[model samples]
Target: MCDECNQYFAKKIEKRVLEMPYFRDVRHRNFIESKKRRIPVSKGIIGGAVDLKKRKDFGTEVIVNSPDIFQKILNGEVKHMIIPVNDQPIEDNKLISRFIAKIAIESAAQTFSSKKGWNNFIINTPEFKELRYYARFGDKLDMWNYSQRRIYNETDRFLNPKVSDGPYEVLHEQNLVFLRDRELYFVLVLFGIEYVISITNPKIDGYKSWLIENNNKCPIIEKNERDTIKGERYF
Candidate 1:
């Protein structure tokens, strides 16, 4: 793997082949850097969703490699190759689909709850409906309960119908390419145990110019920048 690509993965992973009788070794392989190229494996299996924030020091998403690729690794048959996504590493890291998926997983887990007492706390609105083709796997469910929300303190703040948080604010521009029109300029808040929100129609044009003028920074204005649209662009 190139140093740049390696910078985005786990600093170390414990890997093993399913068929191997007695081998447990650290896996080393390059990621498919370019989204344009055809993914070589046709029958890959979903591994699991990971929290990049927990592993932020590593500088990349923590998705497990596909099972098909894992099998090849077990047999020592996998090969390394470099596929360029872009010249700028900043954009490349920002554009990663895994990170977006991670956000969706975290959001879904935080907002969707089945607890009877917290029925009033639910935010059932759907965003980015078209990107559902990519589903999460493993024990970490894509939905969450009120109890879990308290555990993570990941809830939206500012819950009112008129005022709203925008999606571009949540996903950021580098992460906005996969979203549907209605999903843009929408926002959700994760505060303490309570998730707060306000419903607003999507506004791509207004936010686009706003983001560009502000260098596509955070959609939410910060306290220091409260007076200026140019304040340190919320991230």
Candidate 2:
């Protein structure tokens, strides 16, 4: 990847994705690592003002509407605090589908590039033409149907004895679920939310049916399949 194209994807595509509330809240509340170019979700409305930041000891800590309120809680001057919020992020299907398509293709290319003639195979494959176009130019092509669901809450405190806090949260996990006669599905779990897309076709019914038969288990943590390279990932 040239520096120009790298910057283009980061600034043009990935930036928009990380800014989405689905991502923003996950990164902020869970304090996931985003490296240097990461944008911190600073301000939020929890029925009032809030400042998100790291803690002195470890993990995340939020400063509430005012210093006094925060200090009051610390000093035991305030007994209880309640924050009620309508926290659902608006779904941008087009933007997210583009991302899924982009990563799915890239991961597949990376996996197969080492094999002789595979790169050319991907470049010239007629099946992937529309998906490639959709990834690079969203909405200019017809929208693709994808499925999304939350497996767990973003701020869920998971038990982890290794960390400073007894709890830890998931940052991200992904896998390319490729099987014979099945639509190539990319399963990306970001901060406990699962986003699945079929790269081979626009329909998501294939994944839904697969899930039902598999007892609704997430593909990432499922029993590792011996074969992973029918389509994508570090196969």
- Poorly placed runs, candidate 2 (over 4 Å): 1-4, 37-39, 42-47, 59-89, 152-170, 223-235
Give the Cα-based TM-score of candidate 2 against the true structure: 0.70
Would you estimate the TM-scores of all the predictions?
A: 0.25, 0.70
- Residues 1-235 of candidate 2: C-alpha lDDT, one tens digit per residue: 4587568768877889878765665455545557773436555434346666665354555668676667666777766444333244455478788888888788778778899998787778875777777777775777787778766555554543444344444667777877537667888877556888887888788888888888887877745322121211110
Error of 1 at 98 (Å): 3.4
Error of 2 at 94 (Å): 1.2
How much is 152 displaced in model 1, in angstroms? 25
Model 2: C-alpha RMSD to truth? Answer: 7.9
lDDT of each: 0.27, 0.66
Clashing pairs in 2: none
Q: Write the per-residue lDDT of candidate 1 for residues 1-235, one digit (tens) a residue.
A: 2464334332211111111111100001112222333211211122222112112133333344567655665576754422212111122121222333334434544444455633333223343332222222211233211111121111122322333542111211112212233433223222221111112221234444444576544443343432212212111
